[model samples]
Target chain A: MNNDYYSKSYMPGIIKWGKITMLLGITLCFLPALVISFVYGYMPPAAAILTGLLSQVSVSGAFYIVEPISYFPILGIPGTYLTFLSGNTSNMRVPCSSVAQEAADVEFGTEQGSIISTIGIAVSVMVGLVILTVGAVGGNAIVGMMPAGMKEALNYLLPALFGAVFGQFAISRPKLAAVAAVIAIGMTWLLRNGFLDFMPGKNPPSYLVILIAVFGSIFAGRLIYKKELQVPEEEKTEAK
Target chain B: METGKKYLEMANSPLMWIAAGIAVFVVLMQSVIFFRKSLKAAPEVGLTKKQVKMAIQSSAISSIGPSIVILVTMISLLVTMGAPVSWMRLSFIGSVNYEAMAAGFGAQAMGTDLQHLTPIAFSCGLWTMILGSLGWLIFTLLFADKMNKVNHLLSKGNERMVPIISAGAMLGAFANLAAGNFFTETNSLTIGSAPSLACVFGCGIMMVLTKVAKTKNIQWLKEWSFAIAMFSGMFVGYLAR
Candidate 1:
């Protein structure tokens, strides 16, 4: 029989504890790094003192950790996994979904009576974990060989990526895209290439140029459109 | 004696490997959470299953660029010096805490009468260098792509909603790159560092306001939220940093 109705979980206390224990087990397993770093020089004394002063204000995955290295957000591991290994080593993608489906398919009081079905989740999860551990160990050796400095020469990663994205803007709001791009780019170009040369890093304080370019386009557009944007109709219906 | 000392250094600290393991675990858990993908996978938030797959693929490919750079930079540096890989020193990026590692050795050297400056060849510090490089490269790439994809996603999924998420991710990426300069300044030259953060923040604000004020007032608020949220994210990151 197909189980259809969706409601809250009816899992047993043991099962709930099992899940919590598994999570805690993983969390506590992370302690060795602290213990070992201490031996080699994981100076809590130093880090504690410095962390207070340098925390906050980074622009990266600042979501994951309390503090990462450069004040730039480091999205911890999943982001890292996504970045390095095209896919997560854990077939986490498939199995997690499978587990959720199992939970859903499980008739609140009924069980999948067959032996294979009964033991299937436990077995598959074990198999998946073993495979994941193996892959994690092996993937690093190969990834170790990939190139990195290509970023500097190919500094256009941001622009090229955004260019394709903004191209849509150019297509839809050709005038607005043109205006904003020009102002942002021109000011950036001028600040980077022009008299801003007096200052290093090709960075200029934005009250001067970038601000002008960005706000100037915005205000100009607002005046032309009279503070009204052409929003899609679908969103309007949803909003109501 | 120095060679022997270097060889046994792995016993001194395993945190680097542990950090890598911890990091990987955290990542796996997150992937489980965020990649919850729709059952039919028809496209929630406008991402078709296929498009999401392409994005994941492309993101991985883009991230490889940095991983390759770090490895090549190390390998080529070793070759260019005409020194064996064993003799090479890795200057870890972003973390800037290598001095403490050196201090560990300095203490060890004092214990050994400075007779053996040689640290274990396959030491935890060495692994830390490798992990740090890998972490920074991957972290930088994925973060950039995620921010980029959000806009692409909104645009591809809904054409008109594009400008609402616009400018925020771009500004966020630029802000992160600008953070690199701050790290660099902290490490080098003892004197006054130029106002990198201010410039970054201003650039971010300008990107947001430009997109915001141009749209309908209601639309502008939505876009403004994205920008503010991104800055809030940046603030969260800075705290972590």
Candidate 2:
């Protein structure tokens, strides 16, 4: 019933289970590749494998570290485990969790928020798996039947989804929202025009843009809301 | 083309399917376990049964649009990676874009491409896909539990600022992502640009839905608002295009 119970009791159990599942996930992820390579005697030359790994790593290595750290504040501990294991962090997990907290009227980053987000993300994983399984079984036929217009519309879904998510959060804090929008638009413009082409891949690294937008907004929030944020916790709640 | 057929035979083999099944099974098992644990702990965290139920319901509804998008995308992948690998990879630890790009790089490394895959090139793709994403698992395993310190440091020991910080991060991340879509190399806020239209329409619909749901005391509207906003946005974008 108390905060101590959640912090001390509930959290440790989650951490224990999270670690175990993550370990299992890691092992299982390699199973298909291993089976294909060794059991079937289809292993590529070691040199070729190394080249492939290096090429993919050269492009994506930064994301592995940057994404997890940047998303931690929103995803929380249990969410980090579920999200990283289940993937689709931006497109699915984050929106599902954020909407869950909003619909439940729970504050983010609290114990309640963590529990609610875990439920949301777990539900998403189950739902996603069921849909994907169906797709795998007969998706090609169904997709073939789809009209070209309908198929093309799906291309716009990610942008729409992102816009909806931003709206949900921004409505509550317009000033900070403006700050984020300005930085994001400006950075995107710079990236598009070769302003950041000096970076790796002859373009601005996405992770760097993300880092700047996130921290820049946070810095703005801290500066803009300093007085409200500095009030003692009990007094703030009492005033509300 | 002959090598492509041989590669498909191996890729779609029963053994490969079984391996993919095992991988998907692990993901399912983890979700179930975490779901049960969280449900058990809900009351302790002061989440009423109704709140928990709504959370699940809303989240499930929200996932439908994106999941369908993923399914359609998977159809393209199925042609190249076979049903099992496409299913398993998309279900766990990688997005459609990441998997396709990684697999392409893998094949390119072996002097082949997705269209003309040899068995060895296919294997190379699988290896690259697995290895490239390994860092996310390794990093999270090492630091997820310890990341509370990140929040602690950001909040400067002021618990109240945690929510603000989180909100700021959400706004920033989503804004950046949405902006990326709205602005392309060849276009900037051009009329009838599908991505720009989608972003603008999505945001507008959401704001209206939120206002109406709150003013009208329509709980169902609140629950389905996200899906409605998304579909409406996409439909408008389609028409504009």
Candidate 3:
């Protein structure tokens, strides 16, 4: 009952034969994709087909990967294989899933998991595949019936959703939010400037920009809240 | 490649929800057992069990406010800028399904991709804001859910922290001398990184002011620094293309 039995170790154990299973499944999955891409001349197959199980590390490492891929079948095997192997599911989420759901409520324990609940998972996976096919083949056609401009503008949906997220945080502590904004901008600018350029690096400062912003914010957080030091309640801590 | 696509398809299949359901069930079952175990062996009657339950209740809904704010902020900007609805659905659904495939672009892609798609100029205003909002959400959320004793999502956290730290920093004086870069693809008027640095450093000053500076007086500094930083980001983003 204590799913601790689903440890991270199982993924690698599963991966011990990943290449074989994938290689075999490739003819079924990848080969057909290649044929389609060649016919349509889609060029590079839009990454969905180009990459296999490596999608976990290959992608941006956000949350909810499981939900979508699990529902979609084709996207699930590669990412789930790699990520599940590592016993980490964060790579598939919205990146801020915890902000909306608590650790305790979500059992956010980061312990590596194994393949313990195969039956329930397998059932869900089958259901997911049906929905994905129906959605992709039929949904696109039906949804594509919309105006081109409207369709184009629809791209903004996610950003708006994310904005809503920011707005919520801003409401929590407008002043602190404002401060974090300024610091993040400054650190971003500095990192993109000549300073890090002078230091040795291969990828350039752009990649490090996120890190700098985090540091600046953390530094600013400690400094600004220096006076309010105390043990946070477990409830409050879990909400973090 | 067909296999790649197949895998991706399989990954995205609704069937995979079974996996998630199972995982959820497994976790819930484990949690119940864990609580029961702790309760049975506890020094007191259900003390830790009560605490964990309390923790779950208090923590579960705490994220509602900030979480929605950031998501709304990002989604609004995207909507105003005319991004695709599919993209929007994908942002949330992408992860829920297999976000590892779409990545976070489902959140940050609106402005950049739209700009790239159209003949119109770029718009960084929403993008930077989107990035910040997402980053902020990530930081706050991680603290709540991560079971790892150590933190790994540290980079994004810094992005969120900067804004908080800058609430009190003073703006440094600077001249706009940008014929190219930062903002303005043609007008040549741009403060660029110069202003951004000032904005962040000013936040530092503001943090200092948060206490010593008169409470009423402190508010303006926070607003000013935030505005300048966001504006700078927008300019750079809108113009960078």
Best by TM-score: 2
Candidate order (lDDT): 2, 1, 3
Backbone clashes in candidate 2 total 0
lDDT digits (tens) for residues A1-240 of candidate 2: 566777787788888888998898888888888988888888888889888888887778877876787778877899999999999989999999988877776888888898899999999999999999988988688888889888999998888899898888777777888899999888887777767767775145666677788889888888877777877656554212
Model 2 spans with C-alpha error above 4 angstroms: A200-204, A232-240, B187-192, B214-217
Worst 10 residues of 2 chain B by lDDT: B183-192
lDDT of 3 by residue, B10-37 (tens): 3333433332333233323322333233
Give lDDT tens digits, candidate 3, residues A1-240.
334322333333333343333232222222222322343233222232222222232333322221222111111222232223212122112212222112122222122101111211222222222333243334444444646543333332222222222332344345445555554445445544445665433323343443333344445555655433233444333212
Of 1 and 3, the candidate ahead on TM-score is 1
Answer with 2 or 3, whichever has the higher DockQ. Answer: 2
Q: Which tens-of-lDDT digit does each residue in A1-240 have in candidate 1? A: 223211112122222332343343334333433443456553323332222212211111232221111111112212222222222211121112112212222211112211111122222223333333443334344335434432233232222222222332233344555566545545554554445546422134333443354335444444443323455555443211
Docking verdict class for candidate 3: incorrect
- For every model shown, the clashing-pair count is 26, 0, 144
* lDDT per residue (tens digit) for residues B1-241 in model 2: 7878888888888988899999888889888988888898888878899889888988999999999899998999989988989999999999989999989989999998988888888899999999889889999999999998988998898877787788788888888888876665574644357788998888888878876775686767767888888889998888887
lDDT of 1 by residue, B109-153 (tens): 223312333342123333333332333344433343243353344
* Top candidate, metric DockQ: 2
